[model samples]
Every structure is written in structure tokens, then in C-alpha cells.
Target: MEKFEALIGEMEEYGRSNHVPIINEKGMPVLLEMVRQKKPHRVLEIGTAIGYSALLIANNSADDVEIDTLELSQERADIARAYIDRSAYKDRIRIHIGDAGENILKLSGKYDFVFIDAAKGQYPDYFRKVYPLLTENAMVLADNVLFRGYVRGAAECPRRFKTIVKRLREYISLVSENNEFETVIREDGDGLAVSQRLPKENNR
Candidate 1:
């Protein structure tokens, strides 16, 4: 927890300028483990809020690995760019200024790892867009699927957010039920859904 607190402190001190979303250290350590184990050459991140997660992944990965992050907000992108430029990880991370939904379609390279932390309501759409870009054995890590427990207690959520929550629930359910991939839904910090792309032969 100390490491998480330290990360939070750093975010408070400098990341506020970029509106960086705070992450729980619990999920971060696991994410880093996944990156190290996978040793992905290319990583795609759908959201670049302050680029904290992207930086963390890069720091834990091989030096040759590269991270491409998409961020729609110019202000946040600028702040993320500044932070990356000043940090030792500047060379490994590249930020794209545009909506992830449309921008991801234009991306040509295959990705071994995809991290989704964008608009909660758009996660399913993100998955659909990213599916074709993933290489065999690729992994997609979707964050905040549990919506801080609100997902289970749908009756308790507010009217506006309830729809988003329902959508996320559906997305998780659909992914978990799909035989093409093996999905793991873990309850840690807002909940993380990990889906690994199965080999083509495994589909049948």
C-alpha cells in the first residue's frame, strides 16, 4: 500500500495538471507482472490519462518495447506529453491526440497487449475496434468494470450512471461467456477484466 500511496502522492503533486486518473497499486503491480511475463513488443493503451499506467508498463517491460497511447483531451495530452518528455521513459511512449474509437481504426500495427481505461460507457465498442488489431496470444485488460461495486447493485446506482453500469455488466458478461477467449474477472481496486485471445484453432 505504501507504493500506492507514493504513486497517489506523485499524482497529487504533478499529475493534477493532466487530470490523471488515480490507480490502485494493487492492480498496478499485477499489471506490471503481466507485462513482464508477456514481454510484448508493442502495447496499445486506449486511454492516456496522464500516462501513468503506460509509463508504469514501459518501466516494467523490456527497453525495446514501445507503448502507443490514445488520448482525446488536448489539455491532458499536453500534460502527458510534458511528463513523458521530462521522464526517462520519453522514448518508449508516444501519445496520439484523438478519439480512441476512430483513431484505433486507423492504426495498422498488431498489438500484443491492449489496455483499456477510457470512457466507461465505450468499453464494448473499444473491444470491438481492438479485436482485429490484436495478435495471436494478445491480452486485453479492461479497467473499472465493477464500477466500485455499483455493478452488482444496479438498483442503487443513479439514473444516469446506471445505464453505463448496465452496459459494462453486459460487456463483462459477453466476454466471459465467449469461448474464443478465456476471461478472468477479478475484484481489485474497481475490478479488472482480463481477456486473452485464444488461438484460431481453439475457437472450434
Candidate 2:
């Protein structure tokens, strides 16, 4: 475990230097704790940016956990695959390169744990696609949902990011309003929306 932690530190440094977005330290503990408590058998991650978060999940999860991660950019996917191969959880993690929406539909088995950290604007669509694949009591965590706090405030955001902010607001509302799910918005890191699918009996 010490060796893995060291490797994760190295990866974090690499991500910072390379300008690749990875999970922040504040958000790491939240994810780690969720994995520890959930003990999910199958985990799904939407963004495979350099594989930092995916590796983190794999390292913290049970030995039998299977992780499927998606990446849109082939270049990024290559780098992520290399990093994952060097990790102890390499065999348990699978990197799927392509659009997340399409690849998500191709997944066969249901996942009890899902982490979404991909394009901020596509979060609602991703949620729709992954919703059907979630098992009872499944946990779906969406990272960067707050988008640097712009989603909550009226502060002027850059024109390029306004659409993303708008979509994220919609996504948050959709999840929070859904009766089948219970959602909590955490202020860790950029922001995280930790949602759990309610049992059929409890949905009412």
C-alpha cells in the first residue's frame, strides 16, 4: 500500500506538470472513503485523464473489483493506459477509448459504483446513459459539478464556459429532483455530487 501511495503521488505530480486535470487532494479522501464503504464489485469511471483517479479507485477498492474507464482522446488514453499498466491494479482496470456516451452503452454488466469526471456539459447525458446500468443502492459521484463555483453564483463566467455551467446546473437539478435518488452536494475540491439510487420500496 505504501508503494501504491508513492506511485499515486508521483502521478499527481506528473499530472500537475503536464497540465492534465486529475483528482485534487481534497477530493481524494471523499472517493477513497466511498470505495471503502461501498465495497463495490464493479466500478465505472467516465473520465480517464492520465488514469490518476481510476488508479486511485482500483487501489482503494476490494481486490475483486473490476473498473471500466472511458476516455475520448486517444492521446490521453495512451498515456493513461501506460500509467495503469505500471500499477498493481492493472489487470483489474480496463481502458475504453472513444466517446463515453457510446462506450457506456456497450458495457455489459451493472455497476454499483460510478465516478463521472468527464465533459461538464455532457453530464446529464452521461447520467441518462449510466442510470440504467446502476444496481440497487448504486452510488454515482459526479466531480466538478460546481465548475469553480460559477454554478451557484451569478458572477460573470467566461463566455466559453457559460454553456458548461448552465448544463451542470441542469444536471444537478435533475439528479436532486429525482425521487429514485438521494443526492448530496459536497464542497470538496471543485465540487462533488454524491448520489445514491434508492431501493424500489424506499422510492415512494
Candidate 3:
């Protein structure tokens, strides 16, 4: 346990020094709690930045859980691999390097939990692709849904972020309005959208 804590500390420092965005302190508890409660046997992560959240998920989940994390950058995936290699979960978390949008489609397992922290503008696309791959009652947690208080906040969206903010709104709408999902948004770090799929019999 001590060794794992030290390794996690190093991962956090590395992310900060390198400008890599991992989950913030406020939102991490919510994520870990979900992992513990759901006890998902198969987890799919859309973004693996240094493997911070992936490690956390594996640590909190059941002993036999399998985590498949996707990364767009080879360089970042290498860094994440180095970190995972240092932990007891090296064999549990598999990092796939490629465009996450395309990588998600190639995956074929029924994932019970999905964590999305990748391209904010492509969130709707990611959500749509991953929807069919999820098991019933699967929980989809999306990070940064509220980009800098622009998604549902009163702040004006900048010209540069218009598309991203627009897409995020669409992503939220997709889950919120879907008859098969029960969605809730937490106003934590950036913002986290929690959506749980209803059973087939319960879906309208």
C-alpha cells in the first residue's frame, strides 16, 4: 500500500510538470466511489493520461477487474505504461494507443463502467460509439462536461470553445433525454456527468 501511494504521488507530480490533465482532487472521490459501489468486472476508460484514473479504478474495483484504457498519443500512452508497470495492476490495465474515437469502435467486450476524459469536442461521438458496448445498468462517467463553466453556466462561450461547448451540451442532452439512461451532473471539478443505463425491461 505504501509503495502504491508513493507511485501515485509521482504520477500526480509528473502530470503537473508535463501539463497533462488528470482528474482533479474534487472529482476523484466521486469516481472512486462509483467504482467501489458498482464493482464492475469490466471497465473501459476513454482517456488514459498517465494512467492516474485507470490505476485508481483498478485499485478500488474487485480483484479480478479488467480495465481497457484508450489513449490517442503514443507518447502519453508510453508514459502511462511506465506508471502502470510500477504498480501491482500492470497486468490489469491495458493501454491502447490510437485515435480514441476509432479505438472505441474496435473494442468488443461488454463494459460495466466507462470513464470518458478525452477530446471534449468529440464527446458526443465517443458516447454514441460506446453506448452499444455497455452492459445493462452500466455507468458512464464523463469528465469535463462543463468546460470552464460554459456548458450550462451563465458564462459566455468564447469563439474558440464554441464547438467544444456545443458538443458537450449535445453529449449531455443525449444522455439526459435518453429513455434508457438516468443522468445526473455533478458540479465538481470542471464537471462530471454520471449516467447509468436502465435495464432493457425498464427502458421506455
Candidate 4:
């Protein structure tokens, strides 16, 4: 436990110095709690930023859990791979290097838990692509849905980020309004949307 804590501290320092986006402090507890409650056997992560969140998920999940993580940047993927290789959960975590949108489609098998922390503008597309791959009662957690509080009210958002903010709102709306999902938007750490797919029988 001490070793794991030290590693997490090092990763957090690296994220700060390198300006890499990582899960915030508030989001960490939420993520860990979800992993504890769900105990998902299969987990999918859209963005593996230096493998920080991937490690978190792996550490909190059951021993036999399999994690598939995607990173668009080869440089980042290499760094993440190195980190994963040093961790205790190395054998279970697989890092895929490619465009997430294309890679998500190529992925086979269903996932019991999914974490989305990739491109803000493509959240809707990612959700749609992953929907069919979710197992019954699967949980989908999207990070940064409220991009720096811009998605809530775009009037104060910068022109360049308006598109992303608009798309995020749309993504949240789609999840919230979907009949098969029970969605909750949490204000912790840039905002998180936790959505659970209802079973077929329950939906009717």
C-alpha cells in the first residue's frame, strides 16, 4: 500500500510538471467508490493519460479484472505502457495506441465498466460507439462533461471552446434522456456523468 501511494504521488507530480491532464482529487474518490461497488470484471478506458486512471481502476477492481485502455498519442502511450509494466497489475492492463474512435469500433467483447476521458467534442460519438458493447447493467462514467464549467452555460465560454461545450451538453442530454439509462451528473472535478444501462426487462 505504501508503494502504491508513492507511485501515485510521483504520477501526480509528473502530471503537474508536464501539464498532462489527469483525474482530479475529487474524481478519484468517486472513481474508486464506483470500482468498489461495481467490481466489474471487464473495464474499458477511452483515454490513458500516462495510465494514471487506468492504474486506479486496476488497483480498485477485483483481482481478475481485465482493463483495455486507449491512447491516441504514441508518446503518451509509450509512457503509459512503461508505467503499467512496472505496476502489479501490468498483466491485466492492455494499452492500445491509435485513434480512439476507430479503435473503439475494432474492439471485441462487452465491458462491464467504461471510463471516458478523451476528446470533449467526440464524447457523444464515443458514447454511441460504446453503447452496444456494454453488458447488462454496465456503468459508463464520462469525465470532463462540464469542461471547466462551460457546458452548463456557454454564454461565458470562449469562442474556441464553444463547440466542445455544446457537444458535451448534447452528450449529457442524450445520456440523461435515454430510456435504457439512469444518469446522474455530478459536479465533482470538472463534472462527471455516471450512467448505468438498465436491464432489458426493467426498461419495459
Candidate 5:
């Protein structure tokens, strides 16, 4: 994992200079491997905090895939735009500024993958929004579900972030109990949940 940490350092340094949130490169590489395996045609990302994760997904895929990312924070969105504008990947990624849920509702095309890394409390809401946009066999990945190991102790957390953590657990549990998709929780930077849509016959 030393080599992975080196990459994460490099990404964090870049983010420091560019004013964006840096993704955990070590954790992200695993997701990138999954992207490479899936070879998705289109990707929808709900959080573009400086576009780190979206960029990773795009880089792992062939040139044909298009990545659309949403960011609610205008400052972060501008930072992402600047970084994308300076990079060769400018054309491959489009960062939309607004509520991710609203943007998802307005999106016209289907996606082969969706990445969720926004506000923890909104996971279920975001899932509902993105569900209709996913095609058969599409996968959705939600990050930081463990909430720094506080999800299990949400009741003890301070009231503000506590509610969100509780909601996230509920979201995770709901997904776990559902039969329409298969979900796997990974122990990585914070935590990761990967859910792939099951075939139509498997849906209730």
C-alpha cells in the first residue's frame, strides 16, 4: 500500500494547489479497477468535490465514455472546472453546478455507472434519483458509508452530523435488504458500498 499512499500524496498535493478535495488514491484505485472491469459507456457522479473521483473513473475507462459530475458547492465546482479546463480530460468530464438530485432528474440519458460521495444523509434520496437513470447491469458506488466508524455509534455523535450518520445506516440497511440489487460493503478509506442492479426478473 506504500505505492498507493504515494499516489494519494501526489493527488493531495495537486488538490492543495488547485483548491479541491482530494480522493483517497489507495481506496480509489480499487474502484478504478472495478471501472476497468466494467468498461462502462457512461458515468454519473453525484459529488465533484474538485472532480478527483470522476477523473479517476474517466482515466480508468476508454476514451469513448463520458463522465458527468454534480457539485453543490460553487467554489468547489469552479475549482473542478479550472482543473478540468487545464487537463486533457476537459472534454470527457462535464461538471454541473446544482443539487445532484435535481441534476439527476433532468438528465436525459441512461448511465452504466453512478458514483455517490455527497452528503451522507442524502444517500437514499440520491439513490432514488439515480435509480431511474441506470441501465440494466448498471452499478452504483457510495463512499464513506462507515462515517469514520461512527455509523455504529451515531447515537453518541453530536446532533448535527449524527442525524446524517443515522440516515446513512438506514440507507445501507435498506439497500442490504432489497433484492433488486446486490450490495457489498468494503473496508477502505472510510468505507465503500458497491451495488449492482440485478436483472429485470430479479426485481420485485
Candidate 6:
């Protein structure tokens, strides 16, 4: 237990020094709570930045849970692989490299839990692509949905961020207003949205 704690501490420091965007510490509690509450057997992670959140999910998940994580950069994937290799859940967490938008399609099985923390502007695309792969009642958690409060802000968004803010609003609408999902935007950290897909019968 102590060794695992030490490993997590090392990863946190590494993320800080390397400028890798990881799950906000403030939001980890809710993330882990969902993992524990769901106890999902199959989990899908859209982004595996340095494998920080992946490790957290693996550590808190059921013993036989399998995690398929997508990463766009081979360099970051390699770094994540090295870190995962040092952990006990190394074998269970498979790193899939390349565009997550495509990789999400290549997935073979259904997932009870999906975590999205990749490109801020592509949240809606990721949600659309992954919807078919989720089991009924699956929990889909997205980090950075609020994107520094621009998505819901009343003031004008900066020109550089207008596109992303628009996309994020679309993503929020996709889940929040969709009858198939029960969505909530958590204000902790940058922000996180936990949306659960209702049962198939409830969808149509």
C-alpha cells in the first residue's frame, strides 16, 4: 500500500514537472467514488495522458476490470506505458495509440464506464462515437467540460477560445438535454461532467 502511494506521488510530481495535463486533484475524489460505486468490469478511457487517471481507475476498480485507453501521441503513450509497467495493473490497462476518434471505433467490447479527458474541443465527437459502445446504465465521465468557465459564462469568450467554447456547449447539451442520459456538471477542478446512459428501453 505504501509503495503504491509512493508511486502515485512520483507520478504527480512527474506530471507537474513535465506539463502533462492530469486529472485535477480536487476532482479525483468524485472520479474514484464513481469507480468504486460502479465497480465496473470493463472501462474505457478516451485519454491516457501519462496514464495518471488510468492508474487511478485501475487501482480502484474491480479485480478483473479491463481498461482500454486511447492516446494520440506515441511519445506520451510510451511515457504512460513506462509508468503503467511499474504498477500492479500494468497488464490490465492496454494503451491504444492514435486518434481517439478512430480508436474508439476499433474497440471490440462494451464498457460500463467511460472517461473522456482528451481534446477539449472534441468532447461531442468523442461522446457520439462512444455512445454505441456503452452498456445501458454506463457512466460516462468527462473532465474539463467547463473549460475554465467559458462554457457557461455570461461574458464574451476570447476569440481564440470561441470555437472550443461552442463545441463544449454542444457537448453539454448533448448529455444534459438528451433524454437518454442523466448529466451533471461538477464544478470541482476545471470541471467534470458525469453522464449516465439510461437503459436501452428508456432511450427509444
Candidate achieving the largest lDDT: 3
Question: Which run of 10 residues does model 2 get worst, by summed lDDT?
Answer: 1-10
Clashing pairs in 1: none
Candidate 4 runs further than 4 Å off? none
Report how far residue 128 has shifted in candidate 2, in Å.
0.2
lDDT of 5 by residue, 85-138 (tens): 655667889888998878888887899888888888899999987888889999
**Candidate 1 global CA lDDT score:** 0.82
lDDT for 35 in candidate 5 is: 90
Q: Write the per-residue lDDT of candidate 6 for residues 1-204, one digit (tens) a residue.
A: 237788889999999998999998888998998899998889999999899899999989889999999999999999999989998988999999999999988888799999999998999999999989989779999998888888886777899999899899899999998888889898888888999778778773
Q: How many residue pairs clash in each candidate?
A: 0, 0, 0, 0, 0, 0
Q: Roughly what TM-score does model 3 have, to 2 decimal places? A: 0.97
Query: Which model scores highest in TM-score?
Result: 3
What lDDT tens digits, residue by residue, belong to model 3 across residues 1-204?
A: 249889999988988888889999989988988899899889999999889999999999889999999998898899999889988999999999999999988999799999999999999999999989999889999999999999998988889999999999999999999999999999888999999889899887
What candidate 3 gets wrong by more than 4 Å, as runs, is none
- By the lDDT metric, which is better: model 5 or model 6? 6
Write down the lDDT that model 3 would get. Answer: 0.93
Write candidate 2's Cα lDDT for 1-204 as tens digits. Answer: 237877888888999899999988898888888888888889999999999999888877777999999999999999988888887888899999999999999999899999999999999999999999999899999999889889997788999999999999999998999999999998898899999889999994
User: Of the pair 2 and 4, which is ahead by lDDT?
Assistant: 4
The residue-by-residue lDDT of candidate 1 on 147-173, one tens digit each, is 978897534887879878978988898
TM-score between model 6 and native: 0.95
Provide C-alpha RMSD values for all models, in order.
3.6, 1.4, 1.2, 1.5, 4.0, 1.6
TM-score-sorted candidate list, best first: 3, 4, 2, 6, 1, 5
How many collisions between residues are there in candidate 1? 0
Against the correct fold, how does model 5 do in TM-score? Answer: 0.86
Q: After superposition, how far is residue 85 of candidate 3 from its true place, in Å?
A: 0.6
lDDT of 5 at 62: 69
